[model samples]
Target: MLHRVRSKVYADFVPEFDATSVAKIKAAGGIILGKAVTTEFASSDPSPTRNPWNLEHTPGGSSSGSSAAVGGADGSGCAGSQTGGSTCRPAAYNGIVGVKATYGRISRYGWAPLSWSLDHVGILTRTVADGALMLTVLSGADDHDPGSLREPVPDFSAQMAEHDRPPRIGLVRQYYQDYATPEMWAHTEAVANLLAEAGAEVEEIPVRGGPPVNHSVRAADYGPRIRAGMEMGMIIPTSAYLKAQRLRRQFRADFSEMAAKVDVVMTPAMPAPAPRDLNTTGDAAFQVPWTAAGLPTVVVSTGLSELGMPMAVQFGGPWAQEGRVLGAAQWCERIAGLNQAPPNY
Candidate 1:
């Protein structure tokens, strides 16, 4: 995927895989499945893959093929990447599990950067367990990625054990109630209520002032950063970049502080399910804050939309808390009882 995108005629000098990363994947006993399609540099542009549920609609991108390959009618459990809502949106659109691990959890040594500050390496799969398995194999710090954290990797798969007691979950007050579609919001609320009824402590929590505006600015400005690197032969401006970094730190701190009181934060994965039109990808507003904070986020399909398209809720956890996040997501998956492969491939 990296090689092909880098070779494109209009390729704008994005990152590419070096031999060392490929050697490492092989050395780790990983085999290459065929590459999945991505949006240009994993940004806003939509791709050609059709949603398995309805071929006339989009499958979502920049990880379009990965999600379709996994949750499409074939029932092949596959993995894909997410930066903003790439994995989660498709998971919601196609009815699957997509997890965007905390930034630096997976090595960014090989991915083409959409935004150095906001980019995350993630996975899309048929179930939370499948997503967790892929995350275990893919995650770990790498010297090649300066942004990679040196923290010890957790055993995510082991954390899948079902608990007798329900988890304490928090719903960000504004996300579902305000920004999401009525059907999407209703499904998320229903899941929360189900968790509560099943012995979980589910409650609303305010995010205070909400996500930083500069985060979006930084994401949008990344194109210029990549272009500047190519044209001027200079690195990105540290001061400008660091401002976003500082905001990221603030978001992480705030999110962690909130997570101290809750096992997981839940909200609709996207404002709605897949839109019928293929000309544009849907919103990323619901995903940006979590991405900027570098929090572990999982998207679990609740079920079909009013239009019978798929929809999902996102679960987020504190840094390095992917195990708890995945476990909670798995629990939700089992309880929701909505896991089903898309109708047509």
Candidate 2:
């Protein structure tokens, strides 16, 4: 299924042809269910879709309806696009699984671009296994997309099932734990313990990256940071952009080295649960660094927060290593077993 924000375009605005990603789905015999509600241009502007857990809360964007439909009973699954945290954030909010495949892993030919450099085709599904299947089908190079990778697509389903031993998990705690709520911190620690008990090697690791992305400019507000980032993007000098790109490459190198030592890096998907207020999509701090590095990330519902909102943990692997991350998430999902329906569902 497809989902777009009403504010970004007219309800009847139809594209002339299917995006490469959507066409692939059709080739695989998958039906196009329908479009879900997205924020304007998949931006920070809120969409009409509300959290199923609580109508007053945000379902997240710009994949608001994509995640909502998966968590609730609307559709089998949906395709979501992310520039910042559009896909994973909503999946985290709605208590499902979302995968942000490596940049260029999936063709973005027909999808509307948010940031040409940052836009990534993401997958949202009810389980890690489901997400893996979708990724395998959606990934490939397209001549139309210059950024699409020419790398061979692996059998993710088979690889995800190949693990016989627990995988090593590196825990990034510096900024994630420091910025997260107390309850979130405790919950994350509990997950770590569970993983360790399952025979996985869980160790605290200091990330070489400068700082974890907090995105917020104030104590509890993220609006200023979001707007500021957009503003800076508009006026950013070409030289400055190049310098930033170089630094991003360095960060990716550093992270890949870390991933070489561990099967995956674990962090909170967000600093907190989905906010009750509808004025915003929750923070993207925890998901940004990985996204910026063009690494693959998958989020699985860990449990519920105090307000009964979904709290999720994200696992990131080296570029093109989505299968490892998905395997770890599948293991965690089985351990957590968080399959409860929303209160009003």
Question: Which of the numbered candidates is closest to the native, going by highest lDDT?
Answer: 2
C-alpha lDDT of all candidate models, in order: 0.72, 0.83
- Candidate 2 per-residue lDDT, tens place, 263-335, comes to 8889988888998889898877777787777889999999898888898899889888888888888888887
TM-score of each: 0.85, 0.92
Q: What is the Å distance of residue 218 in model 1 from its true position?
A: 21
Model 2 bad stretches (over 4 Å): 8-12, 211-232
Per candidate, the number of residue pairs that clash is 1, 3
RMSD, each candidate, Å?
A: 4.6, 4.2
In the range 62-159, model 1's lDDT, one tens digit per residue, is 67777777766444445455666777787777888888888887777665666676667767777788777777777777888888878887668887
Query: In model 1, which regions exceed 4 Å deviation?
Result: 1-31, 73-79, 162-165, 214-244
Compared with the true structure, model 1 gives a TM-score of 0.85
CA shift at 18, candidate 2, in angstroms? 0.4
